[model samples]
Target: MLPVLPLFVLTVILSVVSKPVVIRDSQFNLPVVRKLNFTGESTIPELDRARSQSILKRPTRIVHGDAARAVFDVAATNEALQYVTSVGVGTPPTNYTLIVDTGSANTWLGAMKPYVRTNSSVDTGQQVSMTYPSGSFSGEEFTDRLSLGSFNVTVQGLGVASRSIGFENVDGVLGLGPANLTIGTLFPDTEATIPTVTDTGFAQGVLTAHEVSISFQPTTEEVNVNGVVTFGGNNPSRFNNPISFVPLTATSPSKDFIGINQTITYGTSGFPILANAAGIIDAGTTLLLLATDTLQRYLTVVGGSNEPDPETGFYTISPANFARLQSLFFTIGDTAYEFTANAQIWPRSLNTAIGGNPNTIYLITADLGTRSGSGLDFMNGMVWLERFYFIYDVGAGEVGFATTPFTHATTN
Candidate 1:
């Protein structure tokens, strides 16, 4: 986990920041809609690659889930590094754009934009903060009303930062991770946990179930809102078949998040790359990361080689070898999920955006920094999620996957 500033240090910063506005008889009970943002917007391709690589290098902290009982469309960002949506706070409701992240817990606001204190905002006098590899935000914790779609939460714990680093052009994260990850983010009440919007909604009976389902469609455009996050249950229109439900992995750290156990094989050869390794499904990470050994094996089996682009830190595949590429298979539980040949490569049309030759093909699978057996061996990132329907059931302690229409489509 990303370390937090000591309470004593945080207190000093709070003294100079604005206090929160408090209100009474507040409760939320409506769904919310948020639009997603990609990396290519207002950013050069090189920058997206640099930021992604920087994030990948940091030690990943196992974060824990919450379901947003509302459904909203998601837009593809540059290289699809992140998916963002809009959220409103306060009675008058100031709308802020936020990254929808399931990799870490702790919902906070005000990094690019300052927190707006309205009648529904109540300063808890407790400090809250979270640090990710790409950015960190710290400020006072507050109980406020959050509106998503037609649903709303009467009291939701969110952070208002006084200062931040790394995050740019976004208000802050809307953490859809587990409530346990919020444990140490607040002070004095160190043992107390802040309920995610999903948790509060379920406790208030706003939703019939405590789960969030996500659907992302592959796109050829640089940016498009073609995905949806459904709160409470699966959207029947998103997938055609029954969902394959798999229990969360028993491994520590990895288990703390939406992690699972799966073995990976390459093409029709069925050569094993990762053998039932423990890994996570993350929305925050951009690439499908694998342990170095597994990555090497995958490269060998595909007759591909990784040549790091000095500018972006992402490996590039020669256009020649890309033509001979094949699909990769992820065998999780009783099913084998095929990562099609088209899904294995980044959008060739956007190569120049990431500082690569316009005609070059780049592989989406990259190194996870460490080798297998490190508790976390792989990261099934947004690229992978875009090909499937993912459901994270908080109360049920299970993750479900279904093949979407994009599962084998050559959209890229």
Candidate 2:
């Protein structure tokens, strides 16, 4: 995915839950932008609750695997909302998902006009519905402090595509991966919820390497804020292990995302790896996807080979390369952990390698362009993130690598 052809950044125009909101306070401003990863003992073992607390009064949890899929929150100013609008080639502008996706970079939601319900038309009031493949829901267009623990994003302009996708617990998605015109901008408040980028002077571009933190949001209580998700910095805990922190960089629509950027180290020498890995942190996606070139390089280190695809501009791989695989590792700040190869990788075939006798654990299908799949794996999914702890720090534009797969008794 070279780059998302600068889609008209379309943020949902939300009605203010509270009117005349004041955003003059810079207390929410991230003071520093560190360029490193942190490695240390995870206090995560001690944390055992449906949610944690935070100071800024938000929600915090190291969402991993299934728990991390297609679930995110976004906050932008009215000006930032304008940055999302754009004029489609032959169509009018529509708001997409200002999703803070981790599995994949680039912010995009369902693009459709203010879809009115069928049957009735004439006297029906203009209603918006942001539906997923699952059921139907409603997004109450209102402006409230889009809060998540300490992370306070004042999106003066936003709307709720009430149409439900998959889960009912999630309201909407927030794109934290790359810096497309999806996050910031200034424009005239048009009558429409939020216009496309073509006519709006709002924000239209990409951004990366920023700080985004989350505090646990409980049903009734002030959340504690501290677990900060910096673009590339150490977690301040467990500072001994040689954790590799990736450098944060800017990105395009289709590629990297709002908070997606980092420096990675692998092999004995610990040379930098996956500088552009930021673009591929997608929650909607179950496997870690990379361009064929990048995939080949990573597979090469692990003895994986590739085949020819004829049209898809790629080839096939051996199943063993994906099957009994090595533990894949990623670092957010300084923390580092190994990923289960068996769960993360599931290649296309078992014996379709073009060369080098390498194998794959996951399958790279043609549906990546669109989240479309069928059959058992799609139904009774045993994939990596079928249910896991994944964190997407949109403000900082980086996704945290952690999961609560075990409720084990560990060495303190």
Candidate 3:
């Protein structure tokens, strides 16, 4: 287990509950945003690249197998590659904005905002510490009353960080991934398993199913909090058609998280870009990252050149052949999902935000740093998720996707 030191505790109100409201038996959805410039970055694209690179180093967990899990969804926007949401911690809760992430578990506080002592806060006498690709935190573990959407979890385990780095302008994170990912994140409690909000919700009968579904929409704006995360159930209104579900890929590294298997082909020429590779769908990543081989084929077929901008680290294409770009097709579980040409590029109107020539078009896909056959090849991040409705069904051991209204929009 990682070493840790004691962090001071806050005086929390230990006894407060909302008017006895009946939590919904079905799905609960809430909106989130892609926070920008939280770390004083000049542009959204630069932040996106940094966040994605940070994500690449932190695999969700080192666990070896899959397990039964539950779910809940949160709304998110596309900004700086980090999704933000509001969470109420403690009693008579002090609302703190947090990152809605699937990459890590163990909800914590005290990055930008100090933890408010509440009537519901109880220190568990254990020191907690977690290291991410972007930041690290050391604090004390506490059980508190946390609320979100229409539900609240009593005794929700959380951390109050006394020391932190990389995370700025945010209180902490609302982990939406598996519970087992929290293993070994705390000292003295290293052998203990910390239950996530979803786990607590399911065990407390606040959620019907042990799963959460995420519905993300494509946005062309620099910043917009316009997406929904559905807990306990799927939202048909968010999807344009029936959903297709595929079992999690059995490949190592990938299987320990939300992994899936799919093949990719480029446009009308039917050129294969990826051949049945295993990868993951992560909310924490900003770009659609593919293995080196697949990215080369994509850039080649699109007639685009790799000209990385120092500001954003993304390849830029001249406007001349941009119209010649074709859609990328993904075949998952016998279903073919077409990624529109426009969906592959950054919003041209927001070009200046990333310190790029306003007239130039940049592709949202990037190289994943390694080749195929590494067990984990591609990462369908915000760019890809925005084009489809995604569901991470933990209890069912599958992932679901459907086309959205903005699936074919040329807004970019």
| TM-score winner | 3
Q: Rank the candidates by lDDT, best first.
A: 3, 1, 2
Give the Å error, residue 300, model 2. Answer: 2.8
Model 3 spans > 4 angstroms off: 1-31, 38-80
Q: lDDT for each of the candidates?
A: 0.66, 0.26, 0.70
TM-scores, all candidates, are 0.83, 0.36, 0.86
Please write out the lDDT profile of model 1 over residues 1-412, one tens digit for every residue.
1111110000000011122221111112221222223332222222322323332211212223322233332222332456665778989898886677776557787877888899999999998876654457888999899877555788798899898776666787777776666666788787677766766766665554566677876666666556767665567777867999998877755776677899998878787889988887876666688877888888887766655566555666666677778788999899999999889887777666555677667778777667788877887877888898988876667889999888998877
TM-score of 3: 0.86
Sorting all predicted structures by TM-score, with the top scorer first, yields 3, 1, 2
User: Candidate 3 local accuracy as lDDT?
Assistant: 0.70
**What digit string (tens of lDDT, one per residue) describes model 2 on residues 1-412?**
0011111111122121222211221322321111001112111101100001000111111111111111112222111001121211111222222323232112222324442222211221334333222222344333222232122223222343535433222223433322223222212221233222111211211112122222111111111121122221123231223323333333322222222343444444554444423333323232233433444556566555454333222333455554444554544555655444433333223213211123322233212221211000111011232222333333222344444322111100
Where does the lowest 10-residue lDDT sum fall in candidate 1? Answer: 5-14
